[model samples]
Target: MSKQNNYSYIGIAFIILVFGIIFVPRIIDRITKGDITRQESRSDYAEEKKAVDSKLSDLAFIESFGEKRKVPDFSFTNQHGKTITNKDFEGRVYVVEFFFTTCPTICPRMNVNLVKIQNEFKDFENFGVASFTINPDYDTPEVLKAYADNYGITNPNWHLMTGDKEAIYNLANKGFYIYAGENKDAEGGFEHSGNFALIDKNGFIRSRIEDGNPIVYYRGITSEDEQVNDEGEREQISILKEDIKKLLNE
Candidate 1:
């Protein structure tokens, strides 16, 4: 081939590469409807894709609930002093966390991370955050409202909930399968998991993120590990955000 022809070929190839770099991701984003490529690793993406695919089948309910775990029905008051019930979340995907307003340890960090999630999904009508306080006696509606105000949480979907202590404990331990109890040795006189539960539209627990590790619906079960560092907490938030997107798409 002529040197001039070779140079032309090289230039065409360069132009193609530039266009690919600039436009391919945009095309993908348009097709996917958003940037769903933020998953940390190829394995994470594969796992989430598998979950999404399986969720379309009849086996999804079984997969999401290994032993048919469903969050038991309950009525609780939110920061706005309005009643919220399990039935209210019937057709929505919600994130739940066990916490108290006066917690001096992991609760603050957990709340901060939750704000990240709340902001990310604030515009999605199907997405919500339900924060159930373990210390119901201390965290009344007024207290929760104040705490929500401090965090600048104005979203009506983000419910700072407080209700029957025993009911809350049972829901946390039995329904969500996370820790929540009174402990004299623990900070603020209460102990609870910093983990977040991702509940599907049908009231099944689809995923759980404690610290940085994520357990998806089809994956095998795992317990919450609270001894996580700051980096792990941040990673957990990232995983939570990705999983929420997956659930929303479902």
Candidate 2:
């Protein structure tokens, strides 16, 4: 080979050696330490996604005597004066609460959290809320409509319902077992559980598992921003939101 050609070849060989000594080790080190993304990284990501899916899918169904506790049949007039029934909630994930428009305690906080939740899933057509008035006597369709508007509840699927007092109470106490009753001395002239129930697409009551038992209801009295309430109970609104998402996806 000519001198110039030999020198050109040598220069190219030296450059290759330099690249191998520097860049190659870094590239190899990155691969070894998992710092460089590879097909394995995508696999790892899929595994993580699967784990999340599993967590979301594990929401427990509230059961009684080995049979899943489905939402009891109900028919009530909504804020718009339209009759709503359990069938209306078919194929949707929803939250249920018992509150009177004039409740003096817990109801406001409960609804504030609910409205936050409503906003979170506002874009979801299959997500909704069912606010059954404990004081149906006072919460007529017009009254319920005013309450919904006052609270900025804009979700089209949401329904603030009122109906026959006896049926409403039975639905709350006997059907859902959520504890709604008349209490003459109670702050709002009535007492009801400040817990919210989550219903699945199939009308089955669903909840999260704690210690292998379904925690049948979520504490609606606590706000999502309050991690711990005055009773030192952890706020469940955030988890409720997550569970709602899970059910919605299902």
Candidate 3:
């Protein structure tokens, strides 16, 4: 029981503490995975975290472009001609998309997918769809009303909007960050992609899908003079449905 013995005891305790700190995680990992070390544990943790993050992602691929800010407010009208804006959705989850009625490639498919979702989410709460027509010049309130009816989208929750062309363009480019513009030769007043933007209740563009509009837009099969064809646009119906379900389920 001398000072030398006390010092020796303290040194052993410190070594044991360091050993546990270094090896406990590895030991636990080995017992679970059968062949992992501390490094492997760290790697596995990161990968698991990434996979989980990828599943319920609250991020969009557009973040890398230095444009991940919140979506801006703007005015538009639904199929019923009711006034609406991003501000109205400040407390609700919105699955937004950009399309023009004359698009022969993407709009039809996108509508069909949205219809499927509307049909599937009959009982979903607070979550809804907001499709902003790129061809504001032609997709007037009446045109959108008929369009929504044609697709059997009877849900009051769904909104097909058309407003000031320039403002819609701004929302497409600056707010939602999707493709939308005038195309004099494109059989419509404007054109846009089929990408669906999944926006959260907080006005954040959370995720994007690759599924384009339905093939219905490609009907008539005529390259003769001019027509709409969404075939070349991205197909994002599946992702749209999945993420919409996720947001509503939340």
Candidate 4:
């Protein structure tokens, strides 16, 4: 072929290539985002999508309860004279912590976090917080009641419980997977962890939040561990709320 004819074929091919690059998308992205005509034409598709989203918005798929385990079932009296059973709380998410009313350190910090939780979901129904005192003999129902009142724990959702020491200790270990016992000489008198546990509607332990205060944050780990700023407590708190909301919504 002549050189001019060859050049002409090359030019035509380049033009075709440019056209393919630029105009193909116009054909391909016919259903692209924010397209006017496509949007109008596919209104039914959009409506169907919207219907799906709307159904999802209103869908409430509460989870089914699994095999019920015997979580340290014990009889404890609430701050009020109401004798309470753990079975009464079977279908709700409750935050449980262990601290003596006489605790002088992390217990206050723990209760502060607990009160924050209570205040957070104050208007929400079926969520409660309980702090079972290790020194239950000392932290009687009256003492717990007074402590609750003094702490401005006005919401009925918060409780400070007192029971037999052995029962409370066992519940602290088996139910919450924390340590609370009669070591009355530890810094805050009787010693226990500053661990915060979230129990779901079906009594499944969904998550645990560390106390996170540097002064009291060292309780939950091994003895050689050091406190770091990024041990996932913040994310755990967010997940805790999400799981609680999911349980409540269910």
Query: What are the per-residue Cα lDDT tens digits for candidate 1 across 1-250?
Result: 9999999999999999999999999998786753354434666879989987776522233243347557789899998899999988887888888888898977877777777678888889988888899999989999999999998786677888888999999988877778889999987999877777778787877664445544642111111244346454324566566777877777
Scored by Cα lDDT, where does model 3 land?
A: 0.70
Q: Which ten residues in a row have the lowest lDDT in candidate 1?
A: 217-226
CA deviation > 4 Å runs, candidate 1: 1-66, 208-234
Judging by TM-score against the true structure, name the best candidate: 2
Cα deviation at 81, candidate 2, in Å, is 0.4
The residue pairs found clashing in candidate 1 are none
Computed on alpha carbons, the lDDT of every model, listed in order, comes to 0.76, 0.92, 0.70, 0.66
Can you give the lDDT of residue 138 in candidate 3?
Answer: 88
Per-residue lDDT of model 4, residues 1-250, tens digit only? 9999999999999999999999988877864745877667699788988875653322122222443333456688889977777787787777777888877767776665556567778887689876788887778889998899877786676667887878888888866567877654677567777676666666655532336311211232211122222454332343445556765765
Return whichever of 2 and 3 wins on lDDT: 2
> How many backbone clashes can be found in candidate 1?
0
lDDT of 3 at 176: 60
Candidate 4 C-alpha error for residue 110, in Å: 1.0
lDDT (Cα) of model 4:
0.66
Q: What is the Å distance of residue 178 in model 1 from its true position?
A: 0.7
C-alpha RMSD between model 3 and the true structure: 10.3
RMSD, every candidate, angstroms: 18.1, 13.1, 10.3, 14.8
Give the Å shift of residue 128 in candidate 3.
Answer: 0.9
Give the best candidate by lDDT.
Answer: 2
By TM-score, rank the candidates, best first. 2, 1, 3, 4
lDDT by residue (tens digit), candidate 3, 50-113: 8867765533434535755566877899888899877877766666778877777757766776
